[model samples]
Target: MTKVWEASVRATHSFLSETSIQKIKISLPKILQQIPDLIIVEDEKIIAFMGISHQELEMLFVAPEFRGLGLGKQLINYAIKNFDVNKLTVNEQNPQAIGFYEYLGFETYRRTETDDAGNPYPILYMKRKEN
Candidate 1:
């Protein structure tokens, strides 16, 4: 999880300080504990994973090497169809992620200056468009 974060989310998040990164690392265990459902794809080791609650996608991370192989999309599709999730938040700094979600038919409906934990990172609240 940490590795994937570094390669995907962290790499593009140039605004994050080392302190902020450390904070995320420290909080991961607690975050995982709070998630109700987690799905993982692995070959030799974990290549990707998605965490969810009743109707929200909590997390989705695909290892850098496995990206562009549609793992994230597959996980999201599974979440929407199986878990009934239709909304999620993404860091506004991650344009690639924003584009990916947009391609998946999600649209940003809200924006905030800080994240759910009050971090300085901006957040974009998105919901799937009804088709």
Candidate 2:
């Protein structure tokens, strides 16, 4: 969603180009359909959602007004607790997200390419090992 970017620090970063934003918006709904397990966070006036697939995670979004309140961590931890496998991909250039994933004990497993709109984007594969 463009609105999500409008409220996110990542939006201001060079990695969030029009192409990337458009690709994310277009792909999110389809991804959600395939991964119906969703966790949502609601504050006074803001709501965010994160979707969990078989072993993958995606579509993590917090409303602009509700950023920086540890909602992301809560949502992610919820997924970790509920799912057997924990994996996510962050764009290579999105350092903030990469660092956040690392803080949550996700380690980079590989660098890969995603076919988004017939173009390739670099993504870092991160996984949290099971205990």
Candidate 3:
């Protein structure tokens, strides 16, 4: 799972410096341990995973090789159906992620100048549309 997370982040989070990536990598294990719902898709090895808590999608990552295969959508849809996941935060620099979430009916509700760690990277807070 750690390898998959690193690969996915390297592939998509171009805005993160190597130093920033390493810093996050150090704390990932703790973060993973804290999440209550860890949904994973595995085929021999873990291909993708998402964390859900209190109806919020805390994290989602697909192995770089498995992206664009609708796995992310499938996972989020499953979360919505079963776990009631609705809100999430995405890096503002990651337009691809923002677009993907928007395509799934999430709309930006707020913005933050820095990420949770107080980095310069901005974040977009989003919520799935109520229907």
Candidate 4:
């Protein structure tokens, strides 16, 4: 799972410094342990994962090899259907993620100049628009 997360981050989170990535890598296991609902896709090893809490999709990661294979969409749709996940935050620098979520009916409702850990990366708070 950690491998999946690291690989996904490395592939998508290009704005992150190696130092920040290292910090996140060190903390990801504990963070995953804390998510109230953790979902995984596996084939011998984990191929993708999601962390949900309080109706929010806290994290989603797909291995590079598994990307473009709809694994991310499947996991996110599962989270929305099963866990009532309607909210999530994405790094503003990650335009691909923004477009992905927007395609799934999410809209940005707020923005912050710094991430939760006080990092310089901008954050966008998004929610699934109610039908």
Which structure among the candidates has the greatest lDDT? 3
Task: Estimate the overall C-alpha local distance difference test score of candidate 3.
Answer: 0.95
- Backbone clash pairs in model 2 (N, Cα, C under 3 Å; residues 3+ apart or in different chains), count: 0
Error of 3 at 101 (Å): 0.3
How do the residues 29-124 of candidate 2 rate in per-residue lDDT, one tens digit apiece?
A: 676677667775655543677777786886577775676789888888888777754899777777877888899889999987763444465888
Model 1 misplacement above 4 A: none
How far is 38's C-alpha from truth in model 3 (Å)? 0.5
TM-score of each: 0.92, 0.77, 0.98, 0.97
lDDT of 1 at 116: 89
7-80 per-residue lDDT for model 3 (tens digits): 99999999999998999999999999999999989999999999999999999999999999999999999999
Clashing pairs in 3: none
lDDT tens readout by residue for model 1, 9-111:
5656777888888888888878888999989887887778889987888888888788898889999999999999999998998888899999999999999
Off by over 4 Å in 4: none
Candidate 4 lDDT over 39-119, as tens digits, reads: 888999989888999999999999999899898898899999999899999999999999999999999999999998898
Residue-pair clashes per prediction, in order, are: 0, 0, 0, 0
List residue ranges in candidate 3 displaced over 4 A: none
Query: CA lDDT of each candidate?
Result: 0.85, 0.71, 0.95, 0.93
Consecutive 10-residue window with the lowest summed lDDT within model 4: 28-37
Q: Local error of candidate 1 at 81, Å?
A: 1.2
Please report how far candidate 1 places residue 126 from its true position, in Å.
0.4
